[model samples]
Target: MKKFNLFKEIIITDRNVLTEAINSGKLFGIRVDGNICYEPFTLDDILIYRGTPDASLPIETIFGKNYQVLEDNDRVLIKAFSNWQEIIGFNSPRATYDDTTADGVDEFSTKEMENIGWHASEFNIKYRTLVDVLEDKCEGTLICIEQEEPYQFSGLGFIDDLADARDVLFEYCQREIQRLINEDEDYAQDNLNDDELEAAEFFKI
Candidate 1:
């Protein structure tokens, strides 16, 4: 219910909006295309050397309209999710936001990533950031499909069979519906209990 100190996520349903956000300097570390460029993001790497594959690259360049990113939580961002164009999902401690309120800011940037514990990208720039993902030309895509849920993503993928994809996504939708029903039941139960308590207090029995 409450995402305290967590990176909020939203599912992107429109590519046009994604392009608009990225072009407006509203995103970074994007992995939309079929290539892998690491940062639209930053890193506090130990040593920027060949020994470490910690070099950064800009991403989200060659997104195919027919593709669909899959759900991935089994791997870390640097492993499966953070590729040139292929995408999975990510996990770790929560982290986002810009550096507007920080002590000072630079002209080209918000100095936002500096407030970092760890960072992630958003579908909307209006959402609070954990770190700056828009390091270069690349930026990740996120969108708000529902008001209650924020950060739940599978990955960036191409839609192979449109019909099949729809069916699969429908399953996801049904699952979400069940979750909503369960949540509503919980709230209703809680309210009923509260009413019962209030009635007991009034009766003084």
Candidate 2:
């Protein structure tokens, strides 16, 4: 089964407000030991984690020592994106496996299997379903919430919480583009040629 690490602080006093904020994506937050502590007032999931002002001690110290302040009536939510994506091979329209022939009259040959069917496989359906989450509008807002120090908005799992499947696909394309660039400098430079680079801006969408 697929799973995700969801760290949420439950607010006993103002439960409704916190829940609403999570749904609407308007909650303010601060980092407490790699976990995001969200405000129970707003409804925006800003994905921002403001650490303690004191630079001497680590953020963890504040949470460890002054945890009572946070635990008063609210709960902290710390969920990792690792459990968001799952590859379930279901309703697979096509199946491709290695077919090897022993060397006898002819030399042994192995075939490379790929998407060799017309219909979507079970795994494909699963993937598609996951992709859909990042494209279509969702009942609740999907956010990339993190409690660690702020970092660039680009990179793997950047769109892991997107509510639109189409947007997820676009994000995937972007990820692939970046991955290719990093993995193959020559290919990236070649692809980045003047005109091609200009036209490639569509991928940013």
Candidate 3:
């Protein structure tokens, strides 16, 4: 039983759109009263809410609100990188305890847990997911909508509903590129020997 309110609820007005989104295996979003309210995730997200009347709010009741709005969470850990190189660099994969987030540990395999020994299932680890980490890193809203293999994206959920995800990412990329360039230029200027710096300054137009 969910407490219902019309002004702030997620309901599907059309079943055809829902079916198309799920069946196409493509990203789909629902706009409620002119705002992007809900997006149907994989089958688990679709059916896991209840046997019937599983509206957007029900799913949100479980996993949407906290991660959707990261500020609500008491525990926020953000990791900083030196530059864009570090942000997009290769990362070595390892075992993770991603059960604490609203999405929980998704699609993690038993074989992947071999390192933890036979007591793995008996021992449950509740910790931060990448979305939690990225919110701290990017300092913006990040959305994850993929139903299958949620972790397949770069960060847990790199999404922006404000505009388009593509537009948002592009803008971020441009800003970071300029920031990195400026950082490198500043480092170069600071590291110059006094004589070189003086000479360079003198040569400046």
Candidate 4:
């Protein structure tokens, strides 16, 4: 549940240089069996560079919208949603004022509750939500989704399906953790009660 470190994985889900990038360090490297391995590293390699034979492109620009890059080099700001346009408004004073009151004292009077109100001023700007940007754009598109995740000491988290790619990566980490624990010859005596150890031994074989 806790990620030790964050790593940006620029995954190429197609037949592109993603694999070569991993293999060559021009893209990324992952852990395997507790060891940092590069591309061409098989599942057994701990640092695996696995993928399909197709390549996908980045959605720098959407069909009808343009994204503004943010201070964060990898992040961008999105103004409009799928169908909704952002609007704003401004508050101003009215032309006429009413001085008649119960105490005969002058008070503030405004038109339309304020001098001027704009729909645009009323609305606020928005950036694409993380889920929206990543999910919507990369859903079924055969492209490489790039984002950061936990770092691994060994066992690569290479995946093909960019959508469920995190699941694949996490699975790799879990398996690697289990492998290391299982490989520890002293693991049996280091932890676990007699009953748990007995059950583990029964299942170990």
* Best lDDT among the predictions, by candidate number: 2
List the global CA lDDT of all models: 0.26, 0.30, 0.29, 0.26
TM-score of each: 0.18, 0.20, 0.21, 0.16
Error of 2 at 33 (Å): 46
Ranking of predictions according to TM-score: 3, 2, 1, 4
Candidate 4 lDDT by residue in tens digits, 1-205? 1111112222222223233543442334322122333444332331222222222424233213322212224323222212111110000021122111233212212222121111111111111121222233332211111233552121112222332533432333334334544775544346655544443343332
Cα shift from native, residue 197, model 1 (Å):
29
* Minimal lDDT window, size 10, model 1: 45-54
lDDT of 3 by residue, 1-205 (tens): 1112222333333333443443554444332221222343321121111112224443223223222211223221211211212222221021122222456644322232222222122112122322233344443222222224443322222222213322332333334334433565642555555553443333230
lDDT of 2 by residue, 61-82 (tens): 4323323223323543333233
Q: Please give the distance, in angstroms, between residue 141's alpha carbon in candidate 3 and its true position after superposition.
A: 9.7
- Please list the residue runs of candidate 4 whose C-alpha ends up more than 4 Å from where it truly belongs after superposition: 1-163, 186-189, 192-205
Encode model 1's per-residue lDDT on 1-205: one tens digit a residue.
1121112332232444333434544323433222222332332211001111111312231223322233233321222222212221221111122122233122212232221111111111212221122211123222111133663322111222334433332333334334433566642324435443343233221
Error of 1 at 190 (Å): 13
Candidate 2's displacement at residue 18, Å, is 45
Which stretches in model 3 have alpha-carbon errors above 4 Å?
1-163, 186-205
Candidate 1: list runs displaced more than 4 Å.
Answer: 1-156, 183-205
Candidate that beats the other on lDDT, 2 or 4, i.e. the better one: 2
Off by over 4 Å in 2: 1-163
